[model samples]
Target: MKRFLWILFLGVTFSSTAQRMVLKKGRVLDSIPVAHNATDNFGLYLPKNYDASQKWPVVFVCDMKGDGLNVLENYKTSAEKQGYIFISINNLTDTLSISKNVLIANRIIVGASAIFSINPSRVYVAGFEEGARFASILPVFIGNVDGVISCGSDIGSIEILDAKNPFHYIGIVGKGDFNYTNMLQTENVLNKLKFPNQLLTFEGGHDWPPAKKLEEALEIFSLSSMVKGNNPKDKSFIEASYNASWERINSLIYSLKMLEAEDLITQTESVYPRLVGLDSLKEKLRQLKKNKIYKTQKRDENAAFNKESLTRVDYAYYLEEDVNTYNFKNLGWWSYQMDELKKHSASPNAIESQMGERLMGFLNALIQENIGTLKKEDPIDEEGLRFLWMLKTITAPKEYSNYLKVISSSAKNDDFGTALFYTEELLKKGYTNKSELYDLKDTALLRITPEFNELVAQYLKGARYELPIE
Candidate 1:
């Protein structure tokens, strides 16, 4: 692996400065100032048993919004249990470019390396959502990022990956997450590049995996370290992780999640081969594959995946067309598509139901991306913005903010009809904050109008203006 020159530079310049600073163990230490740049800070978690005598593996946890303490707290349990030093960047911002964020992350890493006894060969980065994407990109630029724990996201940029400099890529995502398919696809790409990678899926949606799942990820890192001779073999830890894998596999099988169970079994087989015997695991996998129920479940899952792929293509094409042309008429079509997704969610077949939930998540995510792009336009595409806000009202009715945006924008354009129509729609969806309605931006005329007040009164029963005996 190429050397991290940045670390060498910081080690020379900041080591003396860092020697004077004391950090608390067994608790999160927030706002530890970077030695070179005191204004920039990071959160750190030293294991309770941490000692300067031995180097420890470190995981740099990224948070785009820089809620360092919260992100550190979330991973502290596993880090503590696994004896890994955890650090969170406290100044990362999504508003900045990726390059800028990478610079910020580099500074944090430099600071941490200067202050802590971190094993350079076992350094890892981790995060969820956008932060996870950022973490995955770090190994491409910064040398010696041993692995990445990407939660609910895929690689930030696959084109930039160097095949010769592959790192262990461990992705944890939920079955119902929109990024689930993306992570699986990324795994295929990593395999083509011969990158060491694994994808761990759970039974939930687009959120951080539970602590147990994170512990499993850390365990994999530990096992990988032993395999590469970076860390001494710990017999007790290996046996415990092996036993946990079997218990999880059994639970998954008992729950009839055949595919998930099979995936876990495959992962266990790969991780434990060097440390323990795998004959039992291999035979178990062989028998599970031959089981009629497992075969049927696998077939149904593949069919659902095929169906979801086609549906996703349709959604992407139509959403692009709808957004580009400001196709207000197609709003009904989008509504109908959402209804179809709801029907799929209500299906008796578990795989089909999961496909429905995933599709809905994908559509919402796609729409959000379009919305973000339109928001960044120089002139602020009002027509496109209005169309998306209108669509949001249909797809996510409970999101009252989009309804207000639609009403405010329509009124700004002097389209009182559109404004009043959404006013009633918003009220019909249980919006009762009359003060917010009256105070909405660019809706002064619309809010006081008889039609708006009448609709508000009809739904919420306390409009500012009376309907005059109608």
Candidate 2:
């Protein structure tokens, strides 16, 4: 008689006690159980060229909501481009304690290694926002992770950074992301620590980088591996990457992104010396800086950044006071401030435009922090939540969900005027979910009111429950 063991891979389960489970390559497996007895599932992807015979780099991704499949999808193309495996944990929700979430990520790491051909020298972690913060901290707790691709957030705790075992850190952030300044600051800190790191910026706000940028970040990982002798250096790849970097800098110079381009060249200067024939790159960089236009641009950018910083400080101070004192009367003043930021964002001056967006982005992060604190109150601070939510609707006006939150919170307080105002605001933002409006908790009486129904009918064409106006 022979002993038997079960192994599942890609919708197929095999019975073999002698061998570990082997997953199919090339496509995403939406839910692969950690083990038959385990409660959590993980999303996984293997390159089409993957073979059990060859060890491959693996990246573990985390989504705050535990949506492993969706998060894994973002890395699919990048994995294929870089010859890596991608896996995402499905049980690491924000509601869980940080310790628990870290443990969950570690379990997935161990479980995936057991089932796949993972390279011990090249394991990485990546995630967005809360997930990104979790990824940034994991290497501190788990020794196996060699690098992190943190998107839209910085490391949650600076105390955990181990100087002796610094990992390769790639931070991807949007120009308009709330985490933009933090990511830049993190990059500077990593530079001083002599840690291998790169900060990639895109053109949006507080979201995952596009697939192309993810691939670029992964390429940086591959290049770092080659530079460190973890992987054999290919002359063709080295030359292509170096040339691409030069081309980007040149493009930036042509487009009046002198400061950004100078920063990029400076950031990569240490790494490029490893590639042959790139010694002249530094000279080219010096020449770029000496250009009269570059000097002028740098001066203008400094002025804008400094002015924006002072304005942001003022906004932060008053917003906190307003939220704490429930100064609803100051709401009009906040509205005017948002409008001014928007106007600057649309200004013809590049520095002013960028500073404006950054100011707005910073405000979003500040308000969100206040909101998180209010929600964590033992008895629940409804007034604080309402104030922050109202501010959020003005600052992040495009976010329809904030408008919805305001409506629900206002209705709970029986502030029908506030509720009705936000109901119209939500609709104006193109929120057409009639059922969602009807289903909102604590909104029963408010939704049935003639004012609420009339607004709903005006925007969405009809309301589930309407009251006739006299």
Candidate 3:
């Protein structure tokens, strides 16, 4: 009876690790001076099927909300389903400090290796935002990540990565955000440095894992590890396989470069696809048979989804190929472009507090230049002035939507005269939104003409409904 009880307890304990995710149960090493107390800690996830005897590849994932362990859990299930070890850790430093990052990463890695049987040979790092930047540059500071996968943040370092130890990189970014520039630039530098890398861009704003990118990355992993099975292969067979793989890789590069060169086909004064003559590219690629293209090795659509780079109207023009007109152009991967943006990326002081300022600088000009003509003369100029003034009421970033509070209280009283001045300014500017006109409609109800209402309603839904004026 005693033996049976002990056996039951051991089985329960052993199988507890079989669940899809193992959470923040790993060892924590807090080397930071201030975090000396119990607060200095992190987490790791060992899958349910993880065995002490067999070694598995490692993938380090970092997230936003204080390590946000869920990302690890998600990646763990994904890795386990593919037979790999997943390491998730939290950064003690609130900001970007490389030395401390290395310490925390090494601690979890050492502990994971001892207990989880992690394969030291095949380690990968992945993260989002600050976490993404950390994982991307891990090879630079932390020493041993076979490859880096970045989801959302800027890598911040590509100049240091060259042919010597350039990491196999993969990035997924949103097309509508500033960081998409980073993804574009990383691809170029990786290609130039001869590092195997990919970037996928999606039509998103700010953040994404966006189903398609996961599929492509998984495909990259599988193709990258095709020869892992230890069958009865001898010296000659291994040599032949390696040679054949290089040939295939060379062919793919030749094709990818040719495709990238396609940008030369379309650079008009208008900077967009005219959707007409690109037949010249076929001849161009033929002439430069050295052109390289990516060839998908697997049939798995999930693994083939290349969302790291987006197909924007103005796809990047690699400068190495075009030396004359594009000297030191800020195009291509984020890491490379960030090198260009270093001065801009510097910590914001009052001088740089205006970085986020995208408001039209001409708003004040239009208000002051035409305020007289707005009230007494041309109806259109009067309309433009109203918009310019109302725009001034709003602050940078979070535009002032609460016009009720933004305008003077006195404006609410006398025929909303001040409000009328603001509304008319906007219309005269040649850009009309149904939303802004409708906002001032109740106060300046007399100015709400059908033409004005129609234009605003066309672009901004419920602009007319907000004030309920026809």
Candidate 4:
């Protein structure tokens, strides 16, 4: 079966000579046509030193929005530094089913291999956010995916993981990201399944880790390749990486990030066991574990994690109840919850603050998922949808679209009172596009209402319609 899949992936052919003629090294080339599919294309980046004489490791990047060139640019520097060929699929999107996207990814992979001298043993995949979630699952459908560098996300589904077909999984996430807790939990599961995995965290939110962090991931991949005998070992490279790991460990300790320091120590021990001794790392970890500050920080973090877990359950339960019941009356209660989250965010305890932020992000994502699913229902539950959209205005105040949806949907139902309320609320949140307000969908009559115009005049100081003084 694997052989057949391999044949299927490699069957598509491109004129290698012609591709090589136009392709430039050390630059991101956009819109390279897929061999079998004319509509599908991908972005590519070859290291400056790339040559067909030797097989090079490749990282297939998945961008959920299909903006391949832009996503490729984000990873180009790390790929260039690590001598890995980087390619991004231009047609993969979250809107498409996972099966369809995986197929699209397979075609791009086939085209890339046909055009470049790719190292089959060292082939990997990477992505950020939704893209990361997609990349995490690709190895299941595709053959020979050696590793996955998932940024800001965890595995697509733990149930799909197989112990026999293990792939090196490297997750890079921010401490404040909603997925941070999920990644940590996933690491525990991966460890039990005996999958070679590492979770790297930074002090930030749910976005791409810095370029240096990506370089570190590539370095880990390189070190793993050496350990597996897939690449020739370089003593200098191993020592340099070892020294850098120690430096990072110490720096993390100095910054009072005992958790990160411990994680790095564990990762260093795992990657360097073959090339280096374990005595120093073991002793350092023992000492760090005994430190009073480390103990306190670990305790606090555990407490916060427990609290966050319970909070997540409450949020999930309540959100489902509210959505199904069209509990518009509970909107005020949701507003109170948001205020409490704000208070937690401002707490002096860093862990608590981060937990608050994660909770906020989690609730927003939950609401968004509910809204998306609700929109796809056969007989669209307009009331339920409106309630979720109204709730979204509370959960994600800066997201103006939800407010607009509330206005449009409410107006469609002839509830101008709700429409006028959201209009003023949207304006209060700094929405200044008068034209968009006037042109809102299903608000043809509502937009011209005296109430809507008065609210708009009050907030924006200008209304399209001038009301007569009665």
**TM-score against native, each model:** 0.91, 0.89, 0.45, 0.93
Q: After superposition, how far is residue 184 of candidate 3 from its true place, in Å?
A: 1.1
Pairing residues by index, what is the TM-score of model 3?
0.45
User: What TM-score number comes out for model 4?
Assistant: 0.93
Best by lDDT: 4
Compose the digit string of candidate 2's lDDT tens values, residues 243-316. 88889888988897887788678756755657666567778788988999889988888797678778878988
> What are the per-residue Cα lDDT tens digits for candidate 3 across 1-470?
11110111112323433222223223222221112223223455555565566766777666545755666544554654555556566553446467776777776555555555666656787878777877777777766667777886566577667588766677877644446555667777777788776675554545657654554464454445443331222446334533443354346445553222332221110111122233443454455444322122221211312321222111233322222232222223423433323443242421121121101222222333444454565444422433333433431213343233223332444445554444434334443445444454344543354543443454444345334545
lDDT score of residue 219 within candidate 4: 94
| Tens digits of per-residue lDDT for model 1, 189-266 | 998998888898887888899888898899999999999999999999899889989998889888888888899998
Local distance difference test values of all predictions, in order: 0.87, 0.82, 0.47, 0.88
- Which residues of candidate 4, in runs, are more than 4 Å off? 1-21
The residue ranges of model 2 lying beyond 4 angstroms of the native Cα positions read 1-22, 443-449, 462-470
Model 1, position 42, has a per-residue lDDT of 83
Q: Rank the candidates by lDDT, best first.
A: 4, 1, 2, 3
Candidate number of the best TM-score:
4
Question: Positional deviation of 425 in candidate 3, in angstroms?
Answer: 19
- In model 3, the runs with Cα more than 4 Å from the true position are 1-40, 64-67, 73-77, 227-470
